[model samples]
Target: MLTISDLDYRIEARPLFDGASAQIASGWKVGLVGRNGTGKSTLLRLIREEVENPTAQSAIRLSQGAKLGWVAQEVAPTDETILEVVLAADTERHALIQESETATDPDRIAEIHMRLVDIDAWSAEARAAEVLMGLGFKHADLARKTKEFSGGWRMRAAIAGVLFSQPDLLLLDEPTNYLDLEGAAWLEGYLKKYPHTVIIVSHDRELLNRCVTHTMALEHLKLTLCAGGYDAWLRLRAERVAQLESQRAKQDAEKAHLQAFVDRFRAKASKARQAQSRVKMLEKMQDISIPLAERTVPFTFPSGEEKLSPPMLVLEDAVLGYGEGADILRKVDLRLDPDDRIAIIGTNGQGKTTLVKSIAERLPLMAGTRKVPKAIRIGYFSQDQMDELTMGETVLDHVRRALPSDTKVAQQRAVAAAMGFSHEKVDTKIEKLSGGEKVRLLLGLMAMEKPNILILDEPTSHLDIDSREALIYALNDFKGAVLLITHDVFLAEATADQLWLVKDGAAKPYAGDLADYRKLVLQADREKPDPATKPKTAAVETKPVAKVDKAEQRRLASEKRKAASPLKRKAEDAEKRLTKATAALKKVDESLAQPDQSSDQMQALMVKRGELTATIEQAEMDWLEASEAYETAINA
Candidate 1:
């Protein structure tokens, strides 16, 4: 459905894409992957631009009339309900339904009905609700105004709309960044079954492996599309790299043999011709181009020199919340030993954050006791830690500030360097660093004191796969206890040995793995009642009434039919007008879609389309009022 050829683009005089090319077929889910700063987002932008404005010279090209969809931005706060916003995403269905309400021509009305059936328009609301619910929205949230949601929730709503639209070509860039673990898992399943073509830019390894049918790797300023998922791509890339190494090795040996022969025989007149020929042969041989090995800096979380005793931190019967009588988590008894590696898993807003904060001593307990040894040191990493960093300061400045006042400058620089900051990067300002770099800086600062207990909240949200792997390694090698709260299931599965589930206002141990929790989440979403299909309770009558005579009933019916005839005729006339207006609007739309139209002609057609739409809307109102009057008269 999409083809990109010779895509050469530059940013600030630096090459991002140099002759990159790829072709993706219809209904294939492709995961676009690369390390940070590799221009994955830039490539998406180029595709979107090509879709919006096709040109003869453009490198990116999409199938004709294929609708492109993406979460362009978070949904702005508005008075419209979340469900309403999603239902309106299918613009064609919305328009057709409006037109059908007042269409009087029997053939035209039947055609509209058939089209609606083809698109499954009648069940649009239920589908939209399902998408919303899968994204962590409650059933009641469907009726809530978009303005009532926070920024993150609004971003979910935006995602719901695009998914509900079901465009032919869907583009997603780090979609799980705003979701919790449950939501991300739900999205992973949804994409696996998505019918249309999908191109997602994500760093979630599980998602890349399980959801996509192919992997598109962006490396060395080039695009390589491989069959199967991320793991498959890795195997293929490894084989290719090995082949290049073998060819290069063979070529090197041949060159060395020729050189040795040339040196020994060049002065001897008997072998002079052969020596010169060997030199010519060496020059004619082509060198194999092997890519340089990529180096990823490892993350460091230093452990304290003094070994801490067991039960480093403990919370007993704790009621955690923001204030008195406002407890979010109740009766929580948990302990973190020096060897404990615990992961907190639950749905969003289930007090996971509250429990972590309470344990970290960031939030005071309303009731209950939290005990920690006087020598115990706790290192906490949260998204808010990034915000706490000074924008005007450099990486070196933050690292030095976290150290003791008497610590040497050389020691501080060494610490920063260990955190992946180079000499130039150490002096770079915080405001200019990317999200991943900022996370590294935060982790570096947290490691300064060499805390024995680490409480990390969604630490891998901004990290790429390589960095995430590095983090997993660091966490595993560390001697301190780890309490991790992250949406990345892979990281949690790799690092945490114990699972603590936060649910129903309590924190308790879970006896299952991440896969079990995933099943539970999906099952809960399936069990949620779809409002559109829910059965309504009917009122029962308590009193009985006598029946009227047959003759009187017939006379009353006759009078009612006679009284409704004129109103029915008026309704029919309004329907005819609506049908005509809708036809005119369709004609205008077709005209607008034609290529190479004069500017003035295009403007005039757009104006006509608007006017026709307004006319149809007014006719629909008129038809509805007349039809209601006819029914009322007949009932009377």
Candidate 2:
């Protein structure tokens, strides 16, 4: 549990949070949503006590015995192997397990057992492995040095370490940035079953919708807490916006009515006082002004009449990767159609980038017969577009460079305007722009080429929610063939019409829509147990057959109920009764602590408490066995 009261945060005389107050209840999963530079990450830092602000009042307050764990957007790995660093997060638990393994003396074993009672090593190891696998790190990769891993892999390891720590409160900043669809889906499921409270600042819409119980929106230097997920908040917020619009309309009508009355009765003596009072009231009322917002981002692709035919781009037995015998991709085959929107997906370092690079002609294919349509123009936007900007050119000059034939100032201005760059921003140097600004600029320039084939490699990587939505809208409207490789599954769902899964080395194509891809993946996942071990629960999930009907649901439910035997059921009932008795004992303790407690009542409460304590210990043992049996049944 955490609470912030009357918080006011300012930077360089600009208010970031003004009178912001919210309570994050126990087990709350919050999606901290906002635009870029709107202080989402700053707010998380404030809560984690990594940043300080003098203006903020009544600093973050946490529940008793709360531990904070954070996955920073920018992570720096210390000198250690991936496994060593992750294991170090739970050093005490690992130490206990190791000591138990080496213990030979019975007395020492007894002492270790007593210590292990407080921290369950079996549960901790299972949870850590689950997290690591979910993050896309294989057991073989765990022993690799952190320094040897790429930036993205290092970030993943850092995230895994944070989850391993199992803090009471988890603060994740853009957790899905470097993850593939599989990894993101794994994280979504993990968060759904996670025991502790979580607060995440992310631009991934689907992840937010799937994992969060609440949406914390930051706007106008204030915080608004809404129940339910992002979609629910969108619906309610739209209604509120409509209400404000209606109120503003009424104010305009009232103002016009007052003016008409004044004009009609100014000369008449009878209504002069009333009309004047109306004018005073109108002047005194607070103005209902519409809020100023960032202009709607332009969404349009270049209008090209050239149509592409089947096999727009082909790769025959391609082998890709760097260095000798380090084959990241092998024997890959892919075909592109005129209107096919292919989404390349795989876990990190599985050649997603290598494939994208080879396809985009940024890198040479190691050994392959690749073909492309004649005179096909390609527009490519790399992940690091921000760093690719010219140092001296202004934004306007950059747009002009994108169009070599367009010489007129008006035409250049129109192109700049279409990309949401206007007035002073067009004049600002490209080198001075922010990451999001640079992305918009790159996209604007790319649109000018009007290429028949588009290659966007993680275009939404550094973009804010608004910018990403804008880009998705533009891409959706483009009729040309596109090869988009991105980690954001929601963006892929919105933009891509087809999914191309890159597993191991080869590319496998899937038909149908986004939902079909999800169904396929889910069904495949159910058939195979997760490679990493996870804690088994009593609740059973029904596996969807070809036709998901009521009969299947009933059959699955009946089977699950039967799987939990009578012995397990009886033990569960006994545990429930014991928990109720324990609550009653706690009430007895409270009553005895009262100033006006009677001696007879106190003596009776003590007797009941002692009996309840013994009963609870026995119930716990029975419950543990029953739980183990229930878990086994579910896993089976």
Report lDDT (Cα) of residue 587, candidate 1: 79
The C-alpha stretches of model 2 lying farther than 4 A from their native spots are 57-60, 73-79, 90-116, 258-277, 303-305, 322-327, 386-397, 405-417, 422-432, 511-636
Per-candidate total of colliding backbone pairs: 0, 0
Best by lDDT: 1
Per-residue alpha-carbon lDDT of model 2 for 1-636, expressed as tens digits?
989888888766778988888889989899999888889988988887766554463556889888888875323333466766776677567687788999899999998888777766555545566577667776555555564455677788788888887788999988887777777777888788778999998888888898999999888777888998888888877888888899999988989998899889977899989888887988898987655665558656783677767777899898877645657778888887777888876556567777777887887777887899886777888886744576557888888877767489888887788788877788876545777788888877777778778888888767877778887878888878888888787788787877777776777686666666556554453223233344233358888768668898788777876878775687668668656765776787678657565655655665666577667666665765676667667556
Alpha carbon lDDT of each predicted model: 0.86, 0.75
What TM-score does each of the candidates earn?
A: 0.82, 0.74
lDDT of 1 by residue, 1-636 (tens): 998998888765888888998999999999999999999998888888833434312888899999999998777556799888888888899899899999999999999999999999888888888898899998778887775565688899999999999999999999999999999998999999999999999999988999999999999999999988888999999999999999999999999999999999999999999999999999899889998857899988889989877789888998899885568988888888887999999888889888888888888889999999899988888865544577557888888888889999888888888899888899887755788998888887887778899989988878989999999999999999999999988899999999999988999989999888899889873336466643223458878878879999999989998878998899889878876886687678778767678866865775576578668767777876788788889887
Residue 30, model 2, lDDT: 94
The deviation in Å at residue 210 for candidate 1 is: 0.8
